[model samples]
Target: MLDRSSARDEVVRLTRDLVRIRSINPPGDELPAAELLAQRLKGFGFETEVVEVAKNRANVVAVLRGRGDGPALMFNGHLDVVPPGDLSTWSRDPFAGDVADGKIYGRGSSDMKGGVASMSVAGGLLAASGEKMKGDLIITAVSGEESDSIGTRHYVERNTLDGIGGIVIPESTSLELVIAEKGTIWLEVNTYGKTAHSTQLEIGINAIEHMVATLHEIKSKWESIGYAKDPYLSPPTINIATIVGGVKTNSIPDRCTATIDLRPVPSQEHPKIIRAMQEAVDGMKGKLKGFRGEIKVINERLPFATDPSSDFVKMAQALGPSTLGLPLDPPFGVNFFTDAAIFATKRSIPTIILGPGEYDLRRNIYLGHQPNEYVKIENLEKATRFYYELSRSFLK
Candidate 1:
């Protein structure tokens, strides 16, 4: 077995290779990364296939068959990452994939490129050792995670969930296993009104003003929805992410729109959220002049929850305190969403969210989409071992 420190070095090298690909989500130039991973897995004698759902987006799944009787395990991670924002904030080149001061600095280092590396390393190590196991190992590197997660959602909905026992999303877990993730609801609110001159405000309705009122109502009512709670996560959170109104300051804009993102816990019903927004908007119409508005609610994603006592969660937990020398704690819920939600909600497969990165190392904290983004090397190293041991617990 490789020592923890050396194992980290190997993972760092793999992560550097992956981050260098720059598979940013919008463009999702993940073909190279997916092909690279597929080739590596093929070299390891695993059955691999590439599925291209959309332009510039593809998902890769590799399977290493083991003893037929044991349960199969799936290791999943996303190759796509949010774009690196602002160049000046980073100490090193965001795409350089450089290793310095015992840290690998680059975009997608923590959010998930590091995870892809750990999965690759774990699969590769198991192959190199020629280990015999009771069940098969299926590794999937997917795309479009940062966007609507169409790649994963499509795979789950359209394909057969055959020959797979359980799934682990190698998200940043700070060396802990994440067993549950919060669900997401995204809606775009459009407040419509007639345009008028700034001075003659009474002649025409001010849509921007009406929209602002609607937004406030949404904020207030969203809080009062009496959403259910979980002990592990903070109360359900809501944010008015984007707002836009009149093109210029002088005119009373005829239209104003605001985008709202709601992170609902498992207890919150998705349809109820949409209904509440409708009620909020209807109430706003009565309060403002000509309160004509439209609410477009889309299923951004379904909330994902897993039974903590399941064998899969318990099996991963077994390694945390024993072989990996990490604390064993019941998995908690996370406010930020991930692809795992699809497995638990759509497929009825219990999904866990834990990975290697911690809260402090979050890329968004460093303005992930805004600048030179990177993840710590030590953290990636720690996670690689977790993946290895987590994989081994199932077999030889």
Candidate 2:
């Protein structure tokens, strides 16, 4: 059997090792992390595979079989993390895996190398024990979650969910069990116009000017008529994430593009949201003389939410972390998206995001995808214990 102290230490080591790998996506080099994870999973006595999704990037799915026909369980974490933009901004080397002041500090630390480590070590401990649980356990360390879920999409499309019964997404959440996590749909809107010389600005339609007007209109509708306020979560939020297009200031620009991020709950109708945004864009076109651009839906993502009173939620809450070994504050929804939507979409399973890390605020506690990201040593220990009891509870 795996000793608790030994197992915990192993997990800590796993975090540092993973952090050292520099699996930064969007110049995506997740192979190092994926390769290491595949080796680790194999050493832990699970049947593992490393399959590529895009170029050299790969995802690992390791399975441990249980004795009976009890419901199966899945532990999932993404292997890829966002690029650490400026290294000089960090106190230490971002990928150095520096352990300091009761926490491991570096890129991918809390935002989720820690979660990945915890789940990886959980798999190892199960293997070391050599005792069969009540159901099959899948340890999936996927790639590209930070970049667009290319890895997960490949896995989901290629594999069947025949044996899996439920999923546990061990994302960083400051140790609380999250009942609902919002979903995001990435969209790009383009506005077009005619170019003109500086002196004759009116001769050419200013796409930038038209874009500004359309943007204000879109934001107004987004704020007023399109608002969806869940008491637990924020009013369905809209983030104007990016905008570009234009040359020298003297030139009357002919094109402008805007990228918006929308966070919605599962119950909210996503199609209507898309339609509203489209109509809002269409309405602004008539105001411009030479406009030729049209807004189009670029990509879509599903949203999932779970009732706090449900059995699965209660089961998770039973082993959830708290201040004094009692039920903590009521669970809430996160503005971020997780694979919880995949579970909801594929199996109609009631999946809730749980484990360590924070939401709504950027803390070292959750500096995921940023340089100097970190997870507390204490938090990792707590989650390990919690997940152990949670697994045990599943049988009873």
Residues 1-396, candidate 2, lDDT per residue (tens digit)? Answer: 355768768778888899898888776678889889888878888899998877878888898778866877788888777778887888888888888898888778776778877777777776777677888778888887776777777778877776666677878777766767676777788888777785687588888888888888888877654445675576677888888978978878889998888887665777887788888888875766666667776666777777677777787776654421536348767777776665555656666566554433323234566556778887777776666566555643
lDDT of 2: 0.74
lDDT of 1 at 265: 82
| Model 1 per-residue lDDT tens digits across residues 239-332 | 8988888977788899988888898887888788889888999898679878899888765677777777887788777777764566646666
Candidate that scores best on lDDT: 1
TM-score of each: 0.90, 0.91
- What local lDDT does model 2 show for residue 362? 23
For model 1, name the residue pairs that clash: 85-370, 85-371, 86-370, 173-355, 173-356, 178-353, 178-354
- Measured with C-alpha atoms, the lDDT of residue 298 in candidate 2 is 69
lDDT of 1: 0.76
Clashing pairs in 2: 172-356, 173-356, 173-357, 174-356, 174-357, 175-356
